[model samples]
Target: MVSKEKLNRINELSKKSKEEGLNTAEKEEQHELRTEYLKVFRERFKKKLDSIEIVDDETGNNT
Candidate 1:
């Protein structure tokens, strides 16, 4: 999971972007944070999908 601080920074950067704009450094930081956030989210989602069990009631078999 991404840390609270990074998440907070991501929000802050977004607000700043809409309100005024971000400098190059801030934009880079925001991009990095977003990428990290997505990576973590996708990994967790994949894990959940992998854990799912599908069963056929008629055959009493698990796939």
Candidate 2:
């Protein structure tokens, strides 16, 4: 999971971007933070999906 501080930074950067635009360094930092956030999100989502147990009651089978 992304840390709370990092999440807050992401939000701050987004708001700054929408209101006043970001400098080159800020844009790069935003990009890096967003990438890391997405990567972590996708990994956790995949794990949740992998843990799901599918069952077919009509066929009396578990898949």
The most accurate candidate by TM-score is: 2
lDDT of each: 0.96, 0.98
Which stretches of candidate 1 lie above 4 Å from their native place? none
User: Residues 1-63, candidate 2, lDDT per residue (tens digit)?
Assistant: 999999999999999999999999999999999999999999999999999989998997887
What C-alpha root-mean-square deviation, in Å, does candidate 1 show against the real structure?
1.2
List RMSD in Å for every model shown: 1.2, 1.0
**lDDT string, candidate 1, 1-63, tens digits:** 999999999999999999999999999999999999999999999999999999999997996
Off by over 4 Å in 2: none
